[model samples]
Target: MYNNKFYVVQDGEFVNPNTNHLFSNGLDPKDFIVNQDGERYNFVGFIFNSEKILISFPKHSFSSTDLEKLPQNSVMLNKYIRILFNCIKRTVNNRNDKYVGIRNELNSDYPFIDFLEVYKYYKRYGLFTNEKEIKKFGYAGRISWKDTMNKSPKIINNHNLLFLPLIIKENIEQHVFISKCMAYVIDSTLERFSLFLEGEKTNLHTRDIDFSNTSLVITQLKKVKRTLFKNIHQHLVDSLISFFEQEKTKGGNYQLKIYSFHLIWESMIKEYLRTKFYGLNDRLEIEWSDSARNNHFEKKVAYPDMRGMNGFSIEPDYYLILNNKRYIFDAKYYQKLTKLDYKQVAYYFLLKHFETNRDVNGNIINELETYNALILPTEYEIYSEVHFELNPEYNVNESKFVIMAYYLNTLKVMEHYTNAN
Candidate 1:
């Protein structure tokens, strides 16, 4: 947090819902923390309301809230935001085969808003018992036979806890409260993003639902838990709860724990390479091998047990062969590759020892290049790669990197991460 504010564009910063919420201050990234060692976070268009940290759907689509500092120009900011969006998407897609998702709408007609604003547009503002109409029953409630006898005036007066006229509509009370809470948030959302009249929110449902009560909305949403029906799915209820919690601060602080983002980064890098070399197998033909020459991209090398039945499948981050040369890629999310790292070496020797995959010469696959790289999401014009020399004296067997350590340009790959196959 910087200046006691998170580095994320607040909902209030957005002027309109169109243009995908870009070209507005609201989409500006802020309070971005990558690794465990949290540092100062300060950036324009990023001060927000969430006290802790969370992500919010400001522009209809969801994306990670973390971003590295870049040029202050709108053009740069907009591109970076797009990159972050694609990065998270790639990350999600990598973890799961497909995207099974759920989220509430950001703008336009809200579900609750349509019910009050457009659906009831024709109904004039009048007193009705629908909800929030505090109707009072003037006459007394039920009277028992003993009350008419007036045997004891005190006993008759204090019959049933002294009150029967008070009718607590428990069901409607929750709905009304929820609707009011939703309306308050919707109006606040419109106030920040849309150009509407002061009281022109909709056909005035009633003064009971405060049109401009952000404080009340936040307090109720964050503090007051509504008693929903038992029939409602817990997931749906949880989603609603999350929605309300997120709305507590329209300009919510999105925090990304970027430490464990290696898996996602690896996925992004793999996808990018796959796109670049789409028809790779057609160009390379070998006598014996698994589907690496066909359609299987992320193939694992499994060495059977003593029984040669089933053993753990040892797999590299990515493996592919082109032009009679094998390529092994490890998409690492670190500052730099270290000498201590030996996974790439293991992959190199494993491929060399594996008998199934070999060149036409009949020797172990000789053409092998491993790239262990750190991914940086910045505006680096060109990507450069350098080979890391290993010292042989350290260990007896581990010599020079059979699995070569290479520095890859990550920003360049992300450019095509979300591109078509």
Candidate 2:
């Protein structure tokens, strides 16, 4: 522990500590130990006061109560710490395949602890409460003779009589439903924590996570069963893979893991908007780009171009379609929007209006209305909405560009969206 502030150490270096209540002035780059790469990690939004350290990670701001729930050496402390360490390790090793762009944005010095906070936000706000289809294997269910033949004879013979084997099949669970996946993650985390509390050593080379847990309420999860007919909870499964999978570095010497906070923030906003506006109008539709290829555009030039390229592809964050109008929104975690940011979104607007002017139908569209906005996070109570009119030379009709800042507090977001006119 540094100055009586308890910190978990992995290989003599502080991994993830409770910096919310730490003494900010005491937090110096030189004070913390370096990683395996021989570099000191940078703690983003870390303020060292004389008495305590105020740490502001993504999705964790303006809320002291949430911080209080996670105190130093708490029962559930190891899970959070393990999460932080794994996330950083994953990003550093380039094991994060889902959010490649966001992973590229991560630096070696970025704090792992802050990444944990962003994951918490995803768990609370982004994940849905629906069931998904997963493959399951068990002897309690019945199946066709052909299906039973696919399973191992030993398992079938051991669980059932030879004559009745054809009537029953071994249940093979393979799909991931929302509730079951949640339970699996919770139970799996608790089991790992139990190992730490019981002084059991994991196969992991590092001894960063070793602690006791208070109790985990998993009674409801135990009742969930895998079903083949259920729909796949794609969002929940995508989010849970980071926590469930055991990803290792290229050298296979250590484990690497993390949930993408960039994706989490975008998902939270998308879900919030959907929930808030779903019942507003029957014709309203919200669409996500999902990938660059989905929203890509090709601009063909007749003459020679600067890069000698025929076209370029552009992808926006999200699209809100209300009747014949389209609103583009880009969620930014930065404190302020820059000129380049504005230009990028404006370019997206130009593409959607001019190049991709067709609707869901194949009918040609002559004119289109488009609006673009940049959503930024702030710590203060200032409610500022700024708009910039596009140049008239573009010849676009009813084009609007806006930069809106909102408080980083999740509660504020809910309140504003739920009560907005």
Candidate 3:
């Protein structure tokens, strides 16, 4: 294959680099596969029977120059590109401690074009670190075919035929930090502007008092305002720094263990909205709820498997109310769906709809009409063409529910559902 595309699915699943499957059962290839669309591209077979392999492509095939232009509906491809950019950006910025392994894996001929595209994107962002930094770690520019025996930045923990996601965690964390910094700048700037105006208003109010009264009042007001703004700005900066510091030590564990990962995911969600949907952040509202406080309804409510409170409460990953429509989206870490997964999302929709009632202080007050939806990650871009309709009963309840499952690339379609449900 000169410039064809391929996908690497480990243990029949497509997930992050540090996922457990890459090293599960003590690093075995029996659980892994490289597929061309639905067809299998056996990496183990290539290793054992090198002569029999005739479909290998050069690593450079992944470059943007080699591959044809991506289709307009290339949802999955976008996600892969994001992942590659983040990983390489992590490595390039010196935020991540591992890069060589990810580079090696991407350089492999398995999914030559995808990997190359990822590398090209990474290079575009100035993420691929320089040789000076690489040599400082004494790597000798060689790829190690061993597990994480060394903590050296250049050393990659290789398994039977692949590297663990944790090894590349440094890269992930770096991008996450940059994301948090951007958020801090935005949030802090808004806060500072608000506080500054409040101070000005206070000063103007004090100026109207008697000469003596005004003098003292103005002085005190100035002190208070100065202190207040200083403290608030410092607090915002501290909060941002503290978040990244905590994420830094989160390590390779997923979910709560490496909890800062959510920051990155949420940031991605926000960035996606800004760039693609003309800044929908102002219109979108997302939150989580728990039933432990007996907020209402007969049944107990708690989201079993989501980002933070894993089984702690029925907090939906995203309970979005956009364009007056209610949507409930749950991010599934698992690639493929089992029967239970479907039922779980279905229950979420039912309960969410059930919760929106007159007895629970529902928001339907006088004029409340909206739709609900439950979406799964994109099975196909065409699936988006199918519009959803809301029942009249939900309008009476003044509550809507929707389940949308989506990958990063497909996030555009999901975000576009402001008027979808």
- In terms of TM-score, which candidate is strongest? 1
> Which parts of model 3 have CA positions greater than 4 angstroms off?
1-27, 30-312, 332-382, 385-421
Better by lDDT, candidate 3 or 1: 1
Per-residue alpha-carbon lDDT of model 3 for 160-230, expressed as tens digits? 43223222211122322222232332333223222111111111122233323324433443443344335
Give the alpha carbon lDDT tens digit for every residue of 283-327 in model 2: 222332323122211122221223435555445666655556555
For each candidate in the order shown, give its overall lDDT on alpha carbons.
0.39, 0.39, 0.31
TM-score of each: 0.44, 0.38, 0.29
Q: What range of 10 consecutive residues in model 1 has the weakest lDDT sum?
A: 100-109
Off by over 4 Å in 2: 1-56, 63-97, 100-260, 278-310, 338-340, 355-366, 379-384, 390-408, 411-421
Question: Model 3, residue 15: displacement in angstroms?
Answer: 15
Span of ten consecutive residues with least summed lDDT in model 2:
209-218
